[model samples]
Target: MAHVLVVEDDRPTAEAIASELRAHGYSVDTAGTGADALALAQAATPDALTLDRLLPDTDGLALLAKLREVGIHAPVLMVSALGDVDQRIAGLRAGGDDYLIKPFAPSELAVRIEVLLRRTRPEAETVLQIGRVRIDRIRREAQVAGEPVRLLQMEFKLLEFLMRHAGATVSRRMLFEQVWNYHFDPGANLINVHIARLRRKLDMPGEPSAIVTVKGEGYRFDAV
Candidate 1:
């Protein structure tokens, strides 16, 4: 299980966030102030963190800088009531991996954290296997049912990321950020075009496509 630290001053909000994360199988620790948050983080580094922009003791950006200065490199999701473009940009500039505005769904928060964790965790194995699809990282090759599949550089990267998180839903935003190194959503059909092409190459003649669209949400890569 992944460990997460949630720092928020509002008691009810903190509890709700913690509860949601625990339900998602994460080990959670909560702090109502920056001092306490720093102490907990220094004592035991967490895998991820959720930080509120306003705290009783310190500003979220300052706290984030402090954490980085102390060598706690956990991915942070900044939660705040401030939804201005500048505020959001500042949060991201301060080392936040993602940001969620107030009144957001707890489930969405969990999903964002999930993405953050996926991005930061190191893949120790050189090869990844999911059902019939497999990729050899060292060789930069992909195979399906033991048959070689020719892939371009971008296709290989997209496939590797999708396979790494098989059975989980990945939004276009997540894909753009992780696979294409895009911080802002392009709002274009670029991903759709690539996904369509990938399906053509990856799917067997009579078998269903391995990638399933999760209507209104994102895409999920089925194991088979």
Candidate 2:
């Protein structure tokens, strides 16, 4: 069973989420303050975390930054009443794997948690190689033929997902769901934009592109 550390300051809200998760066969623990949350996280090392934006002791983003700085790599689902796009971006920038706005259904939360957990699970191979690109999953870094390639967080994630399913046709819908954790069609161009950026970084002058676009379908990472 996967363990979840739920950090919510509201007593009833915390219990409600915990109860729901327990009903779904997950081990749940709750912390009402950031300090306690950090302590519990270090001691127990939960498989996932649900962080509330507002806490009595400290902001959830601050705690998240500290956790990342210390190498706590568990997936984080940040929940906040603030539904602004900027806030969502901030949470994602602060190491949140996913963000949930307030008034969301428990089922939605469950689905998001499941996706996050699955995405963070360790793969059999620590490093994935395809064509000239080498991805170090452990260090979350990528390289092109021994030259280190700097990738933004989302770009790295996009590349990693494609490399994991290398030599297979990956639909845009699947990419959106797996990489962005959104169950709906965000847009073809949105994913295309990221792929374009990654392509620029991963490809060298006069070299074959690592990612191939499958017209009317999705993308395929070439297997060398």
Leading candidate by lDDT: 1
User: What is candidate 1's lDDT per residue for 33-114, written digit by digit as tens?
Assistant: 9999999999999999999999988999999999999999999999999988899999999999898889776766887898
lDDT of 2 by residue, 113-178 (tens): 766887777448888887789989889988888889999999999998888667666767567878
> What is the alpha-carbon lDDT of model 1 when measured against the actual structure?
0.89
TM-score for every candidate vs. truth? 0.82, 0.57
lDDT value for candidate 2?
A: 0.85
List the candidate 2 regions with Cα displacement exceeding 4 Å: 122-224
* Least well predicted 10-residue stretch by lDDT in candidate 2: 103-112
Error of 2 at 137 (Å): 22
* TM-score of model 1 (CA atoms): 0.82
